[model samples]
Target: MKKYTDEFKLECVELITIQGYPVRQAAEAMEVGYSTLQKWVRQYREEQVGITPKASAITNEQKRIQELEKQVKQLESDNNLLKKASAFFAIEMNKGGKSR
Candidate 1:
């Protein structure tokens, strides 16, 4: 995944504002996909009601969500492993052998 920096975002905004470049050209010049730049422009417009010189902002909520998702995935894997281990041990106990 590409990590968009503050400077990169500022440059993109500049391309739109100071340079008077079209959205598609600005996006291409900044080495970002058109949709991504467009989304930023749209968000900046919608959120701030088209305030010129877009803000270089990062939403911490995305990082928080990613961390939470990772933890959930780990917990799920651990639960699955425990279930499998329990089933394996149960099979051993039923076989009349020394249980591990």
Candidate 2:
């Protein structure tokens, strides 16, 4: 419900940068969680350090293969259950037709 303003976020970032407050102290002073403060600090550091752009995310073919494999596994399980049920009913019917 309560959302922080851009100015508040920037001030927290700046306080940590200029005043050199450890994440805990900065978070307490700013009335935010330590983990939240740590997250901001990490993002700041990552931005400063710079990162290479990435490609080669999951391909469509790979996603399709995964989906197909899951479907096959589910169908195989269903087929196995059907086979077991058929065999069980056949045994019961044969017993009824015979004796005992």
Best by lDDT: 1
Model 1's TM-score against the true structure:
0.48
Q: Against the unseen true structure, what C-alpha lDDT does each candidate score?
A: 0.69, 0.68
**Residue-level lDDT tens digits of model 1 in 57-89:** 423343345567679999999999999999999
lDDT string for model 2 (18-90, tens) is 7888878889998998887676666555544542113211223433555676799999999999999999999
Task: Give the runs in model 1 whose Cα sits over 4 Å from its true position.
Answer: 1-34, 41-58, 97-100
Q: If scored against the real structure, what TM-score would every candidate get?
A: 0.48, 0.45
Off by over 4 Å in 2: 51-100
Model 1: which ten-residue window has the lowest total lDDT? 50-59
Q: Give me the displacement of residue 5 in model 1, in angstroms.
A: 4.8
What CA RMSD would candidate 2 show? 11.9
